[model samples]
Target: MASGASTKEPAAAPAATAVPDPKMPPPEKPADVRRRSYVILSFWLIVLLLGLPIWWMTTTIYRANLPLDGMIDWADGKACRPVFPLQISIQADALQPQEAQHLVRLIQHAIDDLNDFSGHHLRLQLAPKDDRRIVQKDNPELALTVRLKAGEATTASLDPHSAALDITYPSNAIPSPTSTSSPLATYIANELRSTFSEEQSIISYLLSTSSMSSDVRPQSLTPTDLAELDKRMTRSLRYAATYHLTFSLFADGSTPNTWDIEEAVEKYMRPLLDVLSPIHNFTVDTQLQLYATPGVQSQVLHKEDLASFINAAEWPLSPSIGGAPTVNFVIFAGNQTIALGDSESSAETSQSWLIPQWGTVYLLSLPDATSHVSSNILRQPMLTFGGHLLTLLGTPQAGSLPLRLSALTRIRSADLLLRSSSTLGSLARLSRSLPSISIPRTVADGVATSMYHLERACSNLGGLEGLMHARIAEEEAERAFFEKSMVGQLYFPDEHKVAVYLPLLGPVGVPLVLGLIKELKQWSKKRKEKAKEAREKKQQ
Candidate 1:
């Protein structure tokens, strides 16, 4: 080789194979082999018996036991049947006790013959002979008082100021105790029926819409009647303990931004609210938005165009954050009038339109220079709004204020009972359908409370006491159904579990499996050796 010649280093020698030593260390002692086996077995035992169980216990979700069957019963209408017993009083101081009793019995029979619905029944009781009271305005227990007076002819008229029906009959029209039927009895029955026809129809409609399919339906009600009632029912707002009345004035220009809203509300609206206080609590708020525009920009808004009349995007009519539902009353200061495709005079006369389940929109034409709206100018608007408020509350159009409010209690209670039951049914279905979801103890407690209150409400359905229970039940049922924890669990999918465990399992699993396999092979080899030695010893 030349002195300065560069040469490549020899390729790395292949690694030498390790040879078994002929003089191996004495075979591993039995104690050591057993110790080795025990070590692997203890690791596996720790993983299988201790670690896995602890992990499972820690990861498992707690689900409280719910009264699924009872909830379902309420939902299906098997738990409670609603019945409203209306009390009617007969006022007849002019007649003898026997004649009054006979007339009362005959009138009840007439009413019974004309009525097929059993859920709503009118029980008539004779007023005290000395009781000269004509109107029972505060007594919700007495639905109506029929004042009978001897007159030239049988004529009936409802007292506009109170819950009294004045009926006059000829002296010969009085029925004797032995009389089976009389024209006078029939006339009073027809008149009473006509007076209460709207209420009965409303109550019957409520019962029919309930989940409990009752045998006592309004067989006498025609489809048109049902359709009209349905419309009213849909237009009404859902009952709440309180209602937020948001009065907003959307002014196209800065003019009319300031109004005598406080004065107008206190004077015109406060009295009506006081009347409604027993059933619903009211909270009032007034706001003025200047340079606001309506969604419809036209001189005459068609009926179809009225739907989008509220400028939701620009209008600050967001509902109150309080739990009570909000009712929006917006007055737009514009010359735009609603077009109902009616006569010009009728169209011009119309000042407002009601938005179903919402509130009302009143159009007021004002000059741009007018800086303020007086309480006098607000009188008609306030009155109109008050009337619309009652309609939105589902008040019957046929009865006096007291009787209508009384009926409202019954209607609201029934409505709450059904709503709570439906919510419970939904929750029960959710629990059954979603096994992985967790139900906290609060949910269980709420469900139990709701069912208990539901029972109480069902027992006292026709009274105001039932309304209290129904409200509580509705609140509890809604709270339980909307439990936040149950909703949170839906996001933890199965894929997340694999991603969490795979890193720890992959590295640790391989060593454990290999050690187990090697131990098994050694055991098999030793067994073979012992068997061969046994055969050799026997042959020798």
Candidate 2:
């Protein structure tokens, strides 16, 4: 009866639970509970404040911000559309301004009708009477100057020494104000077209091969024509700031060992070199290799033999000791004559065959006793070398020397523009494909500089300004794409993070987790005890 009365509502019910659950190990001492809580808090504090930061600092890679969208635009040909607007000046000092302007208008109309490629445009400007100059200091767009004079017949002749055309027309051939199509104007247009036909073809060829929009590319290039142009393009060496010209004389026998090559070069090659100095800087070095046998021993060198003619093992034609590409011009003194047993236009005969992109091999037949090759004897060879050199430099087949050189400048600018664009595109694609790849600051700087120069180049496509910028763009793009630091992280990847962090995380994590669990259980038990005590106090 007394136990039942007390059991009705024991006010100290919470105190009875002070022992905690029997299944739970035991009620921890206050000091022990506080110590375990401190331990767990310390572990978490270290993980959040110290450990995480250290891990990030050690494991994170440096990634510089890049112009990824701009790079993509350039790669896809949406950034720049290359165009060559060739400016030609027409000089007509004898006629009135109005008459000459009319003639110019007619000639321009004829030219426009003839031109098909939109990328290559020929703009004609009438020259001022006081100063008839080919090129002004401020205007570098003058490709060719045409001088018009009245004579007995319409005649046009190119200035062999300079980029000028002297055209004489009959007095009656001069266009009247009322005439829409004058014979004189038509003749001049035909002559000008004839002069620039080669340049137009080459530019058309370049646009066709490039990764440009179809709107700018030539639409009329036949498969055969494309193949021929491609072959010629392949035979030309890649553009460089400097070219090492190695002139090596290989003699099968002891005779003809010494050549007056330096003098010959000065006389024959210097002028041409000076002309080309703007586009390319050339370093000339001559070597004499006696008792050197060419790979082809047979007298009559077939087309197949011309390929293996240069003895790479024996000749000291190793690349020049620099970054510049080497163009080896080897002259081998032998008694062999090329066998032309089949058919050929007799006027197109030659004793020299150009080894594509490498150099030219001229087989000169010298007297057996002669130990020295005179400058006179080397005349034909030097001239042959000059022609081949132009071809090797990707000059068009038909054009005056000055015109060809001028055209070459434009061609090279276009070529470099396409090349740098392709390189940038490749780098952009690489970055997109490899998201985990680390990029160094240097590479980002290089890419930025390259894009900057490329923009400048695109702005000045025809002038020398464009060529210089395009060159810089190419070099920078190459450096950025081949950056060594960017390649290292390719070996280490995201999956590697699991292996690296797991070893340290697994061992340290288990004890910290268990401590946290124990601390939380104590906290939960204390919270329940406080609530029950509050209820009993209220009931009493």
Candidate 3:
């Protein structure tokens, strides 16, 4: 009983208490945790705000603005309708002015009745027949003057060099003001129509080839004619403001090195070039290449050999340095005959074969001892080459040289217009297809320029201005569609982006976020404990 009492009394005594020493300064006051937290928050804010903006700004590409919708519209033939208005003046020198007017009116009415195409219109004007002083001059004031001379019967013939229609009509065949139709008037109208029929057909074909109205296409173009057109198109080079015509003498062996090309070109080719000057500028340069070898080295060239006869890689017939299109006319001195593959056994072999979109190659059989190509020997080749060049440039087969060249200008302009439109369409489609590709300001500028030029070309489709504008439009459209900035960057795959970000963001962000979260939790807990202690103190 005594031991039990001593144990209970001893429990009432104050338990032994352990106190901390005062010299340690309470574990340094926890190192100002709020200040450390403020420093870390400021560091994270700077990293998030200031650093990323600069990096993103530096890595981006400069994109231009292009009128994609408008470009597509133009490409789709929704904009710009092409029209060709031809002015035909008639000068009836022998007839009275009133009679000439009546005749012109009648012919115009007949022409209108005969014409079917709505896009092309032929407006007739009567020139002063009494202006003999002007008509006799070397430079006449007329496109075509109808000299109605008295004859046994009415007949018409065009002047070889001039745009003159000589109509010799009998005095009795003249139409009266009251007559609706006359043999003379019908003959004149039919002749004029016949003369311009080829031009009309060609223009119709061109319009059909282009993205023109579907309603106005010609129905008379046969498959043979279409095939011919295709061949002509394939043979022709793309139109340019200036064409560099290179006349090269390529010989299989090292003989006939020299040529009188300057004289020959001046005498033979210069006239045609001068004639074509109005439509296109021609730059001529001749070269004599020796020791040139053919691609197929055979004594007797088969018909198929002609296709691969010219050594494309080895020949020095490279394009000219100028920006203009280069047309190479080569004359090889070898005795190889070229025949068509379809007619292998035919003796009617061709002496020359045209390289599509290039120039012509003439297989000249010359004596081995010949050292120089005389102008006489070059005459036929030069003429043939000139003809081929005309064909290659898409000159109309019918009509006089001047008329054909005029048609060629119109054709080229149409081609350029269509090509530019197509390019714009492609650009618009590309912009739509690749949404991520940035459209640059340069591309916008190019598109604008192209559209402007396209409009100008459309307005002036029959003249030199049309050609210039069409060319500019084509070049600009090409530039806009192929803008380098638009294709600068690739769409980064999601997997690749994740691969790049995971490496740095995974390790760095995890620790940073955890550290901040832990610090916040500790601070909240401490605040709660302080509040509870303050309440307890106040209550005591």
> Top lDDT: which candidate number?
1
Enumerate clash totals for all models, in the order shown: 0, 0, 5
Which consecutive 10 residues in model 3 have the weakest lDDT in total? 135-144
**What tens digits encode model 2's per-residue C-alpha lDDT throughout 1-540?**
665565456576454546665585776688987887887898899999999999899877878888888887887778988778888888898899999999999999988887777777788888988765434654765788899988998899998877789999888888789988988887888898888766767677877676654357564877887888889999999999899888878898787778999989999998999989989999999999889988889777666667787888878785865888888888889876565544332333347888888888888888778899999998888988888888899987665788778888888998898888888888888888888788889999999999999999988888788899999999999999889888776687668888887998888999888878877887898999999999999999
Question: Candidate 2: which stretches are off by over 4 Å?
Answer: 1-26, 138-141, 217-219, 342-350, 525-540
* Candidate 1 C-alpha RMSD relative to the actual structure: 7.9
Write the candidate numbers in order of decreasing lDDT: 1, 2, 3
Q: Of models 2 and 3, which has the larger lDDT?
A: 2
Best by TM-score: 2
TM-score of decoy 2: 0.88
**Relative to the true structure, how large is the alpha-carbon lDDT of every model?**
0.86, 0.84, 0.76
Off by over 4 Å in 1: 1-26, 131-140, 210-221, 342-348, 366-368, 490-540
- In terms of lDDT, the poorest run of 10 residues in model 1 is 131-140
State every prediction's TM-score relative to the real structure: 0.84, 0.88, 0.80
User: Candidate 3, after superposition: displacement of residue 477 in Å?
Assistant: 1.4
Candidate 3 on 347-407: residue-level lDDT in tens?
A: 7666887888878888888988799888888899989988988988888776566656666
